[model samples]
Each structure stands twice: as structure tokens, then as C-alpha cells.
Target: MPGLDIREIVRAANDRWNAAFNSGDAAAVAALYTSDGTVLPPDHAVVKGTAAIADFWAGFISAGVKDHDIELLDAQDGGDMAYSSGKWWATGLGEDGKALRFEGTIVTIFRRQPDGSWKTCLHTWN
Candidate 1:
């Protein structure tokens, strides 16, 4: 097979994740990660493993989060490993029905799977 385009792969993954998150499908969002993926969210302890990742996202979804957007800044392929850095933003309704918003920069490491798909191995954001 030809060499993979890291930017395209990561962009597609981000699109998929945004769709899943907007739809409130935490499991689908977690499926974009590797089996033993790790996530480090701002002001939270590290979450490891697919199950833990799914649960973490489930909490956000249940809290009425929506309208996620990911803007890819850079992505590079390094054999079986790749990395991408970007900015993300989202908006949702707060408990009092006011608009709540969040935006941050994210850096994620991805691993190429045997099936030629890229999955996030480490995701950290501030």
C-alpha cells in the first residue's frame, strides 16, 4: 500500500469524533481510540483504557454537551506512529440553560493498526 497521509487520516478521525460527540454517542467516540488508549483532560486525572475513555466521554455527553469542532493544525506520519496537534471548541447549554463554551489546544498521538486505520493512543488537552 502507499504511504498514508497523516493529515487526511487525522482530519477524518476528528470529523468522526465530532459527529459521534454531537450525537451523544460516547461509545462511538471512544471507538476512535486504540484499545489501551489514554486521555488526559484538563484538570482531571489520566483516564486509561477504552472502557475508561468511553465512561469519561459519557459523562460529558450526559451533561448536555454538543456542537464540537476540531481544527487540525498539524499532523505528521512517523512509520507506525503519528502525531497531530490542533484546536477544538464546543458549545452547550449550562444547568441554568445558559450557553456554555470551551476551546482548547490538543495534542494526540496515533498508532497505525493492522487494518490500516489510525487510532489515538494518547490524547492530552489543556
Candidate 2:
């Protein structure tokens, strides 16, 4: 962690996130998080734990959400914890069977693992 760059964390997490979410595999997306990770989706109740988090993302996938993208704006690390803020977008099919795009900003917190990798511990978007 001496020369640890936040971008490394960003890349590691974001790459897997985009792949899993876009493929509509909610469980894989949840696996990117820590065991007790939490997601605070805007306007929804607080979601904690990987099981609940998988269900949370499953709802979106089931609703036809796809093409998730994250544009990392900034990130910083303090000790074993780090966070990034960025813009995100996704496409979902509406009731009319037309594509609906949603864009927003998100902040994600990560914790360093023993193997020197990073896992998302917290995430929130609006």
C-alpha cells in the first residue's frame, strides 16, 4: 500500500462491476463487495450484506437494466480505506419496451483485502 494508487482500486472494482452488471449477473456483482457490504440506493431502504445486495441488483436486472458505465472523477485513500466519486449511467427497458437511460453520480468506498486487492464495502448513488 505504500505506492498504492486509487486508480488501481478504481480499475479493479469498476471493471468487474461493469462486466457483471452488464451481463445481468447480480450475484457476481454482489461478489465484488465485501461480505457485509452495504448499498444505499437513492430513495430505497438501506441494503446490507451480500445476499441483500444481490437481490437489490437483481431487481434492476430483472427490470431490463443493462449497459452500466462509471466515469471515475476522483478518488483518494486514507489508510486501508478509499473512496471514489463519479458519474454512472445505465439503460433499462421501460414498460413500453423502449430503452430508458438513467444517469447519476455515485460514491463507493473500498477496503483493502489481505491479499492486497480491494473490495467495495459501501456504495451509494443518486
Q: For residues 1-126, could you state the per-residue lDDT of candidate 1 as single tens digits?
A: 255477988998899989999999999989999999999998999999989999999999888778999999999989999999999999888778999898999999999899888899999987
Task: Candidate 1: give the clashing pairs.
Answer: none
Candidate 2: which stretches are off by over 4 Å? 1-4
- Model 1 off-target regions past 4 Å? 1-4
Candidate 1, poorest ten consecutive residues by summed lDDT: 1-10
Q: Predicted candidate 2: what Cα RMSD to the true structure?
A: 1.5
Please state the error at residue 68 of candidate 2 in Å: 0.4
lDDT per residue for candidate 2 within 61-80, as digits (tens), equals 99888899999999998868
Cα-based TM-score, every candidate: 0.93, 0.93
